[model samples]
Target: MVDLDPEYVAARGVLLDALEALADHREAIVLVGAQAVYLQTVPLPGYQPYTTDADLAINPSLLGPRPGLEEAMRRAGFRLKDEDTGHPEPGIWEARIRVAQRRDDLVVPVDLIVPEAVAPPGGRRGARLAGEHGRRAARRATGLEGALVDHSLIEVGALDEGDSRRTTVNVAGLAALLVAKLHKIGDRADRPDRLTDKDAGDVLRLFMSATSQDMTQRLIDLLEDARSAGATRAAIDRLDPLFGTPRSLGTQMAVRALAGVLDPATVQATCRTFAAQVLAALGGAG
Candidate 1:
C-alpha cells in the first residue's frame, strides 16, 4: 500500500470501521471516489497527493428491505453530520474514533452516494432510502449508474499502522472511475476556476496507472462490457479538448496538482501522450 499521512491513515481506519460495520451489506457496496481509484491503482495510489475522503456508492436494490445502510451506520455510532453541525448536507455522516497516535477521537466523514437511477425521480436529490426508518441516508449521484456493475472485488486493508482491519470490497474499475471523474470535471470545465486540480490530477493518475498501451487496451475491454457505455463515451468526449495537448487546461491543472512531487513539463507531456492513446483505443471517436 502507498504510505499515507497519519490523517489519511486515520481516514482509512474510519473507512475500514464503516465498511466492517456494514459487513452484512458488503456486496451491495460499490466503492467510488478517490479511494476507489486508489484501490485499483494500488502501488501508485495518486500523483503523490493522497485524497482525504472515503466515498461509497451503495446499491439499495441489493440491500434487503429490512435493516438499511443508514440503520447499520447509526448502530455503529455514525450520525448525520448536518444534524450535529446544523449544516444541511444530509448525505454526509461521520463517526468519532480513538486511534493510536491521536490524542482525541478523530471525526472522519464517509460520504454516501447512490446511482441516480435508484434515487427517486423528480429529484429532491437523495437516495430512495427509508433507511428502513425514513432517513436521508445518501444523496443522488450522477454517472454512478454503471458503477454498480463496472467494478472489481478487492481485498482492502487499513493504511493505519496500528489498524489491522481488512475486508473485501467492490471498487469501481478504470472506465467507471474515469467516467465518474469526468462527470465531475465536465461539470466544471466551462468554469475553469471551479475545476479542482485534485480532479484533474486524478485523471492523470489513472492515465498513469499501467503502461499507456496496456491501460488503453484494458479500457477498451472495460468499455465493451460496461453497462452504461454512454457515461464512458461522454467521458471520452471530454478528453480530447481537455487533454489532447500538453497545454490543454486539464493537463495544466494536473501539472499544477502534481507540481509538488513531479517535474511540470514531464507530467504535461505524459498526460497528453496518454490521453492520445486512450482516445485512439476508443477509435478516436471524439
Candidate 2:
C-alpha cells in the first residue's frame, strides 16, 4: 500500500466524528459513493489517499421535517455551510466539508454524497459491496458514537446483511451497478446544476482504470440503447471522450507507457476529457 498524505489523516478525524453521529442511527444511514470506496478496504487501484468524508443514503423518512443533524455536526467542530443541499431546514446539512485549517494551501475536501436510493433488501446500510473492511469500519464508528456521544435517538446496526444475495452474488452485480449509474445520469439532468467538474473528473478516472473491454462493450450497448430511446446529443457528447474504441489486451498494456511520461496534471486533464465523452454517450442514448 502507498503511504497516505498527512492531510488525509487530519481531515479523517473530522469526518469520523461526523460519521459517528450518522451511525448513531446506523440502520437509517445507507452507505454509498466515494466514502464506500475506502470502506472497500482496498485502495482504489493506484490512487494513494485516505478518504476523509462519510457518504450515506438516508431513507429520507428517518430525517425529520426539521433538520437537526446540523447540531450534531456542530458539536464535533464542523459547521454546516449555508450552501449545503442535503439538509436545508434548520442550521445546515452538508454532504461536503472543507477543513478549516490549511497546510500549504491544501484544504482537504470531504464529501458525503447521498444517492436517491436506499439499500435493496438485505443490504447493509451505506455499503453493499463492502466486505470485511466496511463492517470493521462501521463497527468502529458505532463504537465511537456509543462511547463518546449522547445520541439517544440513534440506533446502531439496525439491519444486517450477512446473507444478502445482492452483495454475495459476485462481480456481475457490481459491474451492473456501473451500468446502472451510467444510465442514471439521464434521469438526473433535470438538475443541471448538480453536475460538477470534479464529479466528472472522478467518473472519468474511475471508468478509465476500473473497467475492462467486456464492461466497456456493455456500456456501449447501453449507450446505443439510450440513443435509440431519444437521449440528447449534448449530454451524450459530454461523456463520450472518456472512452475510445475498445482496446486489445496488448494495447491496454501499451497505454501504461504514457503514464510514466504524463504528469498528474496531464492525467487529470485526460480523465476529464474522457469523462465528458462518457456523459455525452449517455445523453445521446436517452
Candidate 3:
C-alpha cells in the first residue's frame, strides 16, 4: 500500500472524532461517499486525498426524525449550513466544523443523507431518458438504507499518533458502494454541474483495489440480481456512455489535485479495465 499523506491522516482523525461523537447513532448510519472511498482504498496501493466532506447515510425508517440528529451534530462541534449556499450538499443536511488551532481555517464538512426509497430523477431530461426500468434500478442501487444496514465495522487511525484515537464505524460494503457510484454516474446526465470527475475516479480506484476475478464475479452477481428485478437491458445500456464520455470539470479538478500522487497511466488503465468488466457483466447489451 502507498504511504498515506499526513494531511489525509489528520483529516481522517477529524472524521473519526465526529463519528465518535455520534456513537449513539453508529448502528443507524453507514459511511458512504468520498471518506468511505478513502477507507476502502487505504489498504490498497495509490493515494487519493479525501475531500472535506464526510458523508453518512441513514435509514429514516429506523432512525425516525432528524431534528435530534442535527442537535447531536451541533453538540459535536458541527454547525449546520444551508444547502442553497455553496457547500457540501450530500442530502438533506450539511454541516462543517473548523479544525482548532489550524492556521488555514481548514474545515471538515459532514453530510447527513437520508437514502430515499425512490431517488428523484437527475433532471427533467434524465427522467424522460431513464424510463421506468432505469429509474427502478437507479432507485434500488441508490436506496442503500436497507442494502447497507449490515455494514462492516472497521478501525481507523492508529495508537501511535499523539491522539492515538482509533474509532470504528459502519461502512457500506464494496458492492453497495459500487452500485451507488454507478447510480450517481448515470444520473449525471441531468445534473451535469453536480457530477464531478471524482465520481469516475472513485469508481476506478474501487475497481483497481478489487482483484479482477472477484470484481467480475461480484458485478456479474449484482447485475444478474438487478436483471431479475425487472431492470431491463435498456436500463443497463444507459450506463455505457458514462464510462466512455469525456471527463467532466469536477473530474479534471480531481485529477489535477492528485497529479503528483497518482500515476495518470494507471488511472486510465483501471478505467479501461472497469469499463470492459461493466460491459461484460451486462452481457454486452450496449
Candidate 4:
C-alpha cells in the first residue's frame, strides 16, 4: 500500500462516522464507489491518488422507515443538500465533517443509493424512505443489485492519528466492484456530463492489483449467483469495446487518467491484457 495521504484520510474519517451512524443498518448498506475501490486496492508503484465522496447501496426493505435515517445522519454532522430536482422533497443528502482540525470543512458526500432491481417502482428520480421525514433520502442506480449481494465485512477506520474509531462495514466484493465500474463506463457513454476517465482507471487498478485468475474466478462465482446474475450479464457485455485493445476508448481512458503518475504505455498494456484475460476466462458471457 502507498503512504496514507491526508485527503484519503479525511474521506475515510467521514465514511467511518457515517458507517458508525448507520451501524444498526450495516446489513442494508454496501459501500460502492471510488472510496471502496481505494480501500480494496494494494497500491502499485505508480498508483494515482484519488479519493472522493462515498456511495452506499441500501436495501430499503431492510432499512425500513422507523427511528429515521436522516436523523442519525444529522447527529453525525451531515446536512441534507437537495439537488433542486423540483421535487417537493429531495432524496439527496451529503455528509460533511472536519478531520484533524483542518482549516476548511470537508464536504464528505455520502450518496445513499438503491438498486433499481429492488428500489420501489416509480418514475421519481430518487427512492423514498418514510423515516427520512418525507425526503427521498436515496437515489436509484443501475447495476447496484449485484453489490448488495456480493459484499463482505471489512474492518475500517480513519487514518488520522489518535482517531481510533473502527467498524466492520460491508463493502462490495472485487468482482462486483469491477462489474459496477464497467456498468458505469457503459452508462456514461451517453451522458457526457457524467462521463470521466476515473471509472476506467478504477477498472485498470482492480485488474492490476489482483491476479487475473482470482478476479476471473470471483466473477464466475458472482455469475452463478441469482441476485447478481443479470448485473453480471450486463457488465460483461461492455468489456470488449472498452478494453479489447490498447487503442480502445476504455483502455485509452485508463491510460489518460494515469498519464502523469504512470507511464501511458504500461497502463494501456496492462488494461488490454487483463481485460482480455478476464473476458476469455468468462467467454464473454455471464
Q: Report the number of the highest-TM-score candidate.
A: 4
Off by over 4 Å in 3: 1-10, 42-46, 64-67, 83-104, 118-150, 158-160, 190-192, 216-238, 244-266, 282-286
* lDDT of model number 2: 0.35
Off by over 4 Å in 4: 1-5, 46-48, 83-91, 98-104, 130-135, 284-286
Per-residue lDDT over 1-286 for candidate 2, one digit per residue giving the tens place of the 0 to 100 score: 4555555554444444555655444444444333332333234445554444433333333444332344445555554444355532222233433333544433333333222232222333232213221211111111111111111122222111221211210011222233323333433445646533333323333455553444344445433442222222232342332233223211222234334443545555454455445455444645
Candidate with top lDDT is 4
What is the descending lDDT order? Answer: 4, 1, 3, 2
**lDDT of candidate 1 at residue 52, scale 0 to 100:** 56
lDDT of each model, Cα atoms only?
0.74, 0.35, 0.54, 0.77
lDDT of 4 by residue, 183-242 (tens): 888888888688798888888878877898888888888778776778888888888888
Poorest 10 consecutive residues of model 4 by lDDT? 82-91
Q: Tens-digit lDDT track for model 3 on 1-286?
A: 4455555555666677667766776776788877777677643334445476666765433453333565566566665454347542233333343454556655555556545433343632111112222211111134343234325887767422567777787887665566666666666657768767667667666766776556545545544553212222333354445543335332343354346666665555555556566667556432
Model 2 ranges with Cα > 4 A deviation: 41-46, 50-54, 62-67, 82-286
Candidate 2: Cα lDDT at 21: 56
